[model samples]
Structures are given as structure tokens and as C-alpha cells.
Target: MTHTILGANGTIATELIPVLKKHNVNIRLVSRTPQHVEGTESITADALDSEQLLSAILGSDVVYLTIGLVYNAKIWEEQWPVIMRNVINACKTTGAKLVFFDNIYMYGKVDGIITEETPYNYISKKGKVRAELAKMLLKEMASGNIEATIARAADFFGPRATEKSIPSVLVFEKLKAGSTAQWLINPNVPRSLNYTPDIAEALYILATNEKAFGQVWHLPTPAPLTGKEFVKLAAKHLKSSDKISVLPKWLLKIIGLLNPFMKEAYEMNYQNEFPLHLSSAKFEKAFAFKPTSYEDAVKETALWHLNR
Candidate 1:
């Protein structure tokens, strides 16, 4: 089987390549500047260009759309729809199944645990874009135009995700540098996080299983820890101080003026103000999968940072 990954060099794709190699499947990595990996084909293509995307996906049994656009809301609003449409069209033309790596932003601020059945009630600009992309793909799936599965994850953390993982940026990196850890808004609200390795493995399982298409699956994630609990656990593993400073909304607003990332992050800060829990019960029951424990995950992440 030939499995092609779009947006190679990303945290999930980097981790997933090894899993695909273990299965001895032919792998193709596609990006504007894809790195050459042993036992895999590399294709240079821009996902936004219809011809390039279609060419990259040709002759594949499965295509994984793992592309992450720029963090700016304006960029996302302008680019996401075009990319999604291009990928869908390419997959349809190529007769390849699609596995979309997605996030929980579309679910917005759920009052309870976020499930696959959660409705799209997005609050921020980014969330609205996500909901539109998801709905577009769902419409195609419902119309029998594509064989695809949506694999959603909460904010993720693990090795190789230091730059993108919120916990890594606020807790692990800060503590490692002998500085106080930071948490957004409330430190007591529960926050769910998916370990990157687990996400990679689950994506592979979904791609290989014939029964897994045409539906949404929440990739398995362990129980959530409050921001304080998360920082404390990370501190225990790192042998550092657990003192945390919370970034209040007003402060974030002020910081947003000078920092582009902070500007985008300010609107999404609502996620941390309340209990953000994700349920992977559907996927766990279907696949009989067990997620890594929080303690083990934290220890492994801390060790990785130390070694690096």
C-alpha cells in the first residue's frame, strides 16, 4: 500500500513516518520543501495549487492531510477553504482515502467533555474557519464523494512538538530554563492534551482500518489535569519549581499589540478559562486502544527536553 503524507516535517508527520515504515508500506512525503527520508519518496508541491496537490496525491491508496497554515486569522480565513477544497478534489480524482488530522477548536467552549457528536458552536475566528472546513469535508463524505475519516485531537504535547505544544511552551520550556511556569487564565480548570506519539499511532490505525472511514474519531487522550496539576506534574518530572504565573486576558491583550502569535492567541484564550475536556470513548472502544498515562507522558517529554 502506498500512503502519502501532505505537509511533511510537521510534528505528527515526523513521528508517523516511523510507524508507517514499521508496517513496510510505501510512503510519500509531500511539501514545498520536503526532506528526503530513507525508504520514502519525496514530492515538492504546494497544497494551495490545485495541479500540484493533485499530482502529489496521484497513485496513492491513502492521503493524510496534516497541513497547518499560518497562525494568523486572516491567513486562515483566506487559505484554509482553498486548501481543503484542493485536497478533497485531489482525493476524489485519485480514488484515495483521506485521513484528516484536526483539532478541537470547532467545538468551541463546550460545557462538558467534547465528543465526536459535539455541535459546531465556534466562538473565535479560527474556530469558525475550522468549522467551515470540517463541514465542507463532511458534506463530501455524506455525498459519497470521498472515503475519509476525521481524527481530532486536543492541544498536543510530546517530543518534537516543543515549538507548537502550548504546555511545552508555557510549562516545560519555562521550567527547564529555571523560570516560573505560566498558565493561561485559570490554573484550576481541567485541560486535556494528546501525546503526539499516541496521535501518530492512532492515525496509522485509522488509515489502515477499512471500517474507520466516513466518520469522525477523537484520537485517544488520557484524562485531563488542571493547569496547576499539569504544571506540578511536569515540575515533579523535571525536578523544578512548580510556581506558575497565570496570563490574564487583559495582559494578553496588551501583549498582543506587539506580538503576532500573541495577537492570534488572545482570542482563543477562552479555552483555558473553563474546563476543556475531550472524550475519546468512541475511538477507544472501537479500537481497544489505551492512551499513555499523564505521569509517563510528562516524564518522557521532560527527559526529551533535557537530552536535547
Candidate 2:
């Protein structure tokens, strides 16, 4: 078996590397500036270039689209379509199965626990982009052009997930320093989060299963936790004070004035305002595997940050 990972340095890819290798699967890790991962071949390629992407995936059995764009709505709108099209086209040319790592943004705001059946009702720049890309892949799969599966994960937190996840950059970084941790929106509202390793494992399972193709699976994850609850759990693991503060919208706006990333975050703040719960009952029922408990995940993340 052979696997080609498109964004090999990403959190999920980094975690998935070991699982794929352990299965004795030949691995090709692709990135713009590729670095060697033990026991895997590393290649430099741009995912947006169909020729380059096709070349990287030439001899692979499964191709994982784990690439991510910067946190800007305009960039997502301009780039995601082209990137998805390129990957889809490349897979078509190479005859490789695709396993897309997706998110819950397309579902938007929901009244109850989000399931795969949730209708696409929310309207946001990022949400629309995700919805469109997902639809595109499914359409291709339906037409028998490519065999593909989609694995959707929630806000992720685990080892090597430092760049964009809340647990690392927002909560643990400050709590480890004995400073108050900052969170966005209503800190009391529970939100779904997935351990990065669990997500990687779920994607791997999907890639190897023939029945999973042409379907969307919510990766197994524990119940939701509020920012306050999450920070307290981290504090318990770190043996530090569990002090947390919610950043008001006005304050975030002021901070956004100078920081482009902060400015872009404002549009997606709706997720924090409401309880965004993702249900993995279908996946768990099918695979008979449960996600890592929240406490253990927090402990592992706390240790990772402490060691860093």
C-alpha cells in the first residue's frame, strides 16, 4: 500500500505519519518545502499545480488532502476552489483514491448536535467555500471519476498542533506561564474539539476501507467542553491556577485593527457564540472505536506544551 499526504507538515499529517508507517504503508509526504520524516519519502510540490500534484501522487494508492490556507476569507474564496480542483484533477489523472480532511464549518450554526445529515444552511465566506469544495468532491465520486471519502474533525488540540488551534496558542501558552488564559466569545458555551492523533487515525481507517468511499464520516470525538472547562482541565494537569478570561467582541475588534489574523477571526466568531457540538455516533457505531477521553487529551497536550 502507498499513501501520499499533501500537507505533510500539518498537524494531522504529522500525527498520521507514524500510523501509516506502522502499517508498513509506503509514504510520500509532499509539501512546498519538504522535510524528511523517518521511513517516508519527502517530495517538494505545490498542491495547486495539477502537474506537480499528479507527479507526487503517481504511484500512490491513496492521496490525502491535508493542506490548509491562511485564515483569511478572501484568500479562502480565491484559493480553495482552485486548490480543490487541482487536487481532484490530479487524482483523476493518477487514478488514486482521495481522503479529504474536512471541518464542520459548512454546517454553520445548528440547533442541535451536528450530524452528517445536517443541512447546509449557514452562510459565511469560509462556510460557503467548504460546502462548495465538499460538494465538488462528492460530485466527482458520484460520477465514478474518483473514489473518495471525507473525514470531518472539529477544533483540534494535541501534540504539534501549535499554529492555529486554541488549546495551544490561547489556553496552554498562558496558563503554563501562570498568566490568565484568553478565549473568544462565550467561554461558557461548550464547543467540540478533536485530538489530533484521533483525527489522523480516523482518516487512516477511512482511507483503507472500501465502504467508506463516497461518504462523509465525523471522526470520533468526546463530548464538547467550554473554554472555562477546558482551561480548568489543563490547569489541573499542569498544577496551575485555572484563571481564564473571555475576550469581548469590542476588544477583539480593537486588537484586529492592527492584526490581520485577528481581524479575519471576527467573521468566524459565531461558532464560539453558540454550542457547536459534533456527533460521531455513526463512526463509532461502524468502527467500534471511541475517541480519546477529554481529560487524557488535555493532560497529553499540557505535557507537550510544558516540554516545549
Q: Which candidate is the best by lDDT?
A: 1
TM-scores for all predictions: 0.98, 0.97
Deviation (Å) of 283 in candidate 2: 0.7
Model 1 per-residue lDDT tens digits across residues 1-308: 99999999888999899999999999999999999999999999999999999999999999999998889999999999999999999999999999999998898989988899999999999999999999999999999999999999988999878788889999999999999999999999888999999999999999999889999999989989899998998999889999999999899999999999999988788788999999999999999999998999899999998888
- How much lDDT does each candidate structure score? 0.93, 0.89
Show model 1 residue runs off by greater than 4 Å.
none
- Candidate 2, residues 1-308, lDDT tens digits: the string is 88999988888888999999889999999999888977999999987787887788898899999998888898998989988999999888878999999988899888889999998875688898899999999899999999999999888999888977877888888888888888887889989999998998899899998899999999988999888899889999888888888888888899999999988877778888888899999999888889899999999999998998
Model 1 C-alpha RMSD vs. true structure (Å) is 0.9
> Among all windows of ten consecutive residues in candidate 1, which has the lowest summed lDDT?
158-167
Would you list the clashing residue pairs of candidate 2?
none
